[model samples]
Target chain A: MQWEIVIGLETHVQLSTRSKIFSGASIAFGAEPNTQACEIDVALPGVLPVLNARAVEKAVRFGLAVDATVNRRSVFARKNYFYPDLPKGYQISQYEIPIVERGSLEIVLGERSKTVRLTRAHLEEDAGKSLHEDFHGMSGIDLNRAGTPLLEIVSEPDLRSAAEAVAYGKTLHALVRWLDICDGNMQEGSFRMDANVSVRPAGTTDFGTRCEIKNLNSFRFLERAIEYEARRQIDVLEEGGTIRQETRLYDPQRDETRTMRSKEDAHDYRYFPDPDLLPLEIGADSLHSIAQSMPELPGAMRNRFVATFGLTPYDASLLTTSREFAHYYESACAGLSGTTPKLVANWMTGALAARLNESGCDITQSKVAPEQLRALIGRVADGTLSGAMAREVFEALWAGEGEVDAIIERRGLRQISDSSELDRLTDQVLAQNAAQVADYRAGKAKAFNALVGQVMKVSKGKANPQQVSEILRRKLALPGYFLPGA
Target chain B: MALAIDDVRRVAQLARLRIEDAQAAPMLAELNTILHLIGEMQAVDTSGVEPMSHPRDVAQRLRADEITEPDRRAALLALAPRAEAGLYLVPKVIE
Candidate 1:
């Protein structure tokens, strides 16, 4: 029987707040061990945890971007657990009521778009990192990440397949980065996801028991883990075995999900409202101000790029992957005299994107400035440089060579568009290849192309291909062509 | 209301508290008395009354995002049972 895969994601977005959520300690990553942990972070006695204004504002901003309801008042609950990294016996999180609720995000897969419903986005403090290696048999606890602000975004099980799950994750990742709320750096552990996957008979409305896969940081891992988990569940059910509703960890090395320690199953979080902190209240004024502060969301900007710049939806989506990239494209397209946005986009998503991926650099770190790219594209449009020659100029520009015009002049890479020059080259090509010329006259169509190739070759790739083709067609079509070179 | 010896033992285990067999009886009796009092209070709940999260009727005050704490790795690590390389070392926890 065919089975349908169902998936839900819980993404933890590390806010870009300068300080810890509850304390004044710096939350900067890669700090020396426990230096960033302060009294409140380490759960010192008599210390009170205070909320961060910036963190709340960011959560509200996210809610607005997704058109979600921003709760006016939310409570902080204590999730009691024991771990070496958790200095506090309990984690402060929003349980019953979160700051943002009932939002939806749109994810695009190929030509189709689907909306993934978001259950809630809550405010919580991140636990410290546990370094398992080194120090003999003992584990080292680094509290530098402790108390860092996180917005745990929980989504409904609306994703049907692993591909949909990946698309949803990528869309959410782009959204967070576009809003400037989270850096969305998966390698840095700033953003991570937990996927709940299950499989049931196709066309069945009833849901299947799902096993939670914890801590999939990268998109590739998310896809692979969900696919493997879904297959595992389907196999178990087909063999008349029950799937245990337990938390499992994805072993990317083995490409499988394994059961985590049963300690996770025995977790009685004993969630209760923390008496130490009062309910978090967001006023109407603050909400309105945060809404105003939110930048144009990715979806809106993508639509604008399609309508305003006359770009394809896919091209627009690619360009708007990040706010910086969209800005770069806009800057390059501004005041463009002859080039179309489509041409600029092609170079960006095709050539420039490849270069950026090769060097592991982002658009902001590109050596070729927007103005330089615009100049290069303009040369191609104005017939000053052929498409191939323009690419060479682009490579030189990327390599920190001189300006576009200077490079073209220095390398003699300009397209020979002069009619006289192109005519002379075409005559020389026809005269040198009498056998091919006679074949063209005798009704062989391909020989005509061979003649044009010779013209381009004689011009050392500087001749305008379109002009050479036109001249060759005109001369070869006429009867009785004498061999001048002979 | 009453409590079993097993319940008391399980609670102690969950709390990570070491309770001897002799103390289990007294702890169970004391916990049963507290539960009896709580059972009496549960009978008097008004349906319209909202559940109170905190005793005080005040909203939380938010602090501005700023780094005012200095690095105190040395002082803090000195208080731990064991520390090395500016990290608190404890029994290895795999899960």
Candidate 2:
């Protein structure tokens, strides 16, 4: 029997704000344990929480970017829980009224596009960190991150496989960074995801037992965690064991998930509207202003690349996947007359990407200037240099050398387009391989490829391969003195 | 809306509490009382009402892509029960 894997993701993006959500304390990571914590963050007596205006603005921007409904009024509730990391004893979050509702994200899965519906995105304060090490059998709490603002984006269970989940996560990652709302840095815990995975029989109406996998910080880990959990659940059900609804932690080292606890319902948190803060209210003018300020998102950018630049859907998708990469590509293509975008994309994807990967640098930090890259592409288009020679010039430019013209002149790497020179090289190749020439005359057509290889080698790979192939075919069709079968 | 004895025990275990089995009966009654009050929120119709995620309506206030140092090293260390060489020391589990 076929099994269907159903997955949803809850992504927590820490807003890149200068201060805490409800307090003026600096929202800086890696601060000493409790130094950044103020009385409000620690939930002291008689301390009332003040909402941060910048944090709310960030949430509004995300809502506008996704074309979701931004509520004019919302309320913060105290999620009552007991933990060492939570200094406030209860976390202030939205339980009933969320900020953004019914947003959709478009993700490309293989050759087809699918839309993943967002259930809601709400703003909440992050809990503090717990240090289990260093203390003698006692855990310590660091409140530096206690009041940091987080935007929890929840998606509906529209994803059907692990690959789709990864695609959704990556698209969300790109969207957040492009909007400049969050840093989307997985390594620094700026962006993280918790995957809720369940499986049932294909086409079944009933849902299977769901498991929440926590703390997946990278796309690779998100895919692996979901895949492993799906298999584990399927095996358990097949073996006549009941699937328990639980929260599990993904162990990246083991590449597996372990049960953390059984899932909790909303009633378990004992939620109530927080009296320390006032109800949030916004006017229409503010929402309109935010919507106007929204930049070109990844979807719009991809379509523009395809339409204006004449790039294929796949090439456009790759170029616009990251904001930095897209900016670099457009800057490189600027002011280059008669250079097709397809050509520029080829060079960027082929030589530039390889160099960036080798140097462990991003597109912004690359040594090759956008203008110099354009010049190299111009050389290829004008036939002054072959594609093979352009690669060599690109390598030199990536190594912080001189410009394209200087590199070509210094290395004598100009293409051999002169027919006289090419003809001499071709004849020399045919004479040297007399046996192959005889075989060709005897109708062994495959033997003619040896002559083309010889001609390219003689020219030191500077010869235009297309021209060489054309001249070889012309010569091979002529009546030869060594025509044996004829 | 009150919690049952088994519900209290289950929630306690989910929270990683080492509660005694004998205390389950009393904790269940207390949890039930809390739930009964919270159940009042369900009476209000939330249809077509948008949920609130944050307090403000502003969007897209990004920090400059520059590094800012967080200068609370001393205060953070003060919360550690044990610290040496700017590192928190934990019990050794492996040799």
Candidate 3:
């Protein structure tokens, strides 16, 4: 029997504001256990919440970027529950009306793109942490992360496979970083993904029951968890068994999903409007102001790269993964004369990217500046330096030795392209390798490359490779050349 | 709906409150009285009335985005029932 997987993601993105959502405590991570917890965050008596305006601004900016309906007035509600980590005994969140609704993100699958519709994006507060390790059998509660702001984005069940779901997750991550709303860091728990996975028989319309897999923080985990859960559901149905609706946790060590709780044991969160905060309102003037200040979105930038710079679809997508990287690429090629984008992109993605990954530094933190790289690119384009020699000079530039020209001169790595000088070297190379010279005249194409290698090696790699190939073709084909050791 | 004896007992468990059997009947009676009053109010709803979250129509008061609070971990830890190593100690919680 054939089965189809259905997936919808609920992503919790922590906004990058300085303060908590409803308190003035610093939202810095890795402080002392409860140092960042203020009175309101810890739920002290007589303490009331004061909504952070900056968090609301972030949501509005995201809404504008996605072309969503930014609700002018939205209410905050208390999701009542009891847990040790929940200091307030209830989480202040949005229930009936969310801040942003009906947004869509574009995901590229293979060579085609599709739009994933969002149900809503709501503003909520993060709970504290419960530390069970090193407790001597007693758990400890750290309220430092309490009251941190989160924008919960729920998507429509439009995805059909694990690959599609992860692609959607990646696109969303890039969009959040592009909008400057979230840092999109999974290790720090800033951006987390939860997937609702179910399987139904192919060519059927009725929906099957779904069990949610919780807190998949990385893209690999997201894909693996969805694939495991969908297969689990299909196996149960194929064996004439029923799948229980529940919440499951993915064990990275085991690479399997385990049942955390049954649906019958789900908490009944008696939700009601939070009376402390009034309904949030965004004025039309403010919406217009934010819309005017919006940066070029990733989708727009990717299309422009393809159209303007003639980049491949894959290269354009990769270059626009982050705003900082995209800006670096633009600056490296910006206002440079006589250079093609193909050359600039090849260097950025190949050489510079490899170096950055090796040093564990971001492109923004690179020692080689944009204009410095542009100068390196310029020399390579005009044949002032061989590709091999250019790489040596680039290392010098990255190490802060000197400018491109100075580094090239200091290392004596300039390409030798004088035709008279290359003619003398070519004569010595063809005489030494009579086999390759005879083979070249006998129409063996690869023999010509062996002759060029000899000329470059004899010149100590100072000879221009193009000039060696060109001069070798002229000397080996003099009309009366004799073949030896053929 | 009115609260029965069992309903009140379950609510007590969820709230982590321990009520003796002797107090269960009176607790049920008092909670039912409050519910009966709430039921009476629910009977009369003017269809056009907007649900009010607060008694007065006022905007929420917002605070500036500046750090005005200092780290008072030692002072606050002094008020905990049991604390060690800058953490609030509680019973070991398992999900």
When sorted by TM-score, best at the front, the candidate numbers are 1, 3, 2
Runs in model 2 lying further than 4 Å from the true structure: A264-267, A335-339, A481-486, B1-95
Instruction: Please give the RMSD of candidate 2 to the true structure.
Output: 5.0
DockQ of each: 0.79, 0.13, 0.58
User: Tens-digit lDDT track for model 1 on A182-211?
Assistant: 999899999999998888899999989888
Q: If you superpose only chain B onto the true chain B, what TM-score does each candidate give? A: 0.92, 0.55, 0.84
RMSDs, each prediction?
A: 2.8, 5.0, 3.3
A452: Cα error in model 3, Å? 3.2
Any residue pairs clashing in model 3, and if so which?
none
Q: Please give, for residues A1-486, the per-residue lDDT of candidate 2 as tens digits.
A: 799999999999999888888887888667655767776776667887777778888999999888788888777888977676676678989878888888899988766889899999999999987666645565556667888999999999999999999999999998998888898888989999999999999989788889999889999999999999999999999998988888889998998999787755422787877766666777788777878888888899988888888887778878887889998889988865443678889888888898889889989998998888888988888778987788889889888789999999999989999999998888778767878988877788788787778888999988888899998888877875434433
In terms of lDDT, the best-performing candidate is 1
Query: What does candidate 3's lDDT look like per residue over A251-353, in tens digits?
Result: 9999999999998778778788887888887888978888898999998998998888888877888888889999998998787534367688888888889
Expressed as tens digits, the lDDT of each residue in B1-95 for candidate 2 is: 56677777777865668779888887877777777778888788899986544455433232332223345556545565665544334443220
lDDT of each residue in B8-42, candidate 1, tens digit only? 98778767799999999999999999999999999
The 10 consecutive residues of candidate 1 chain A with the worst lDDT sum are A477-486
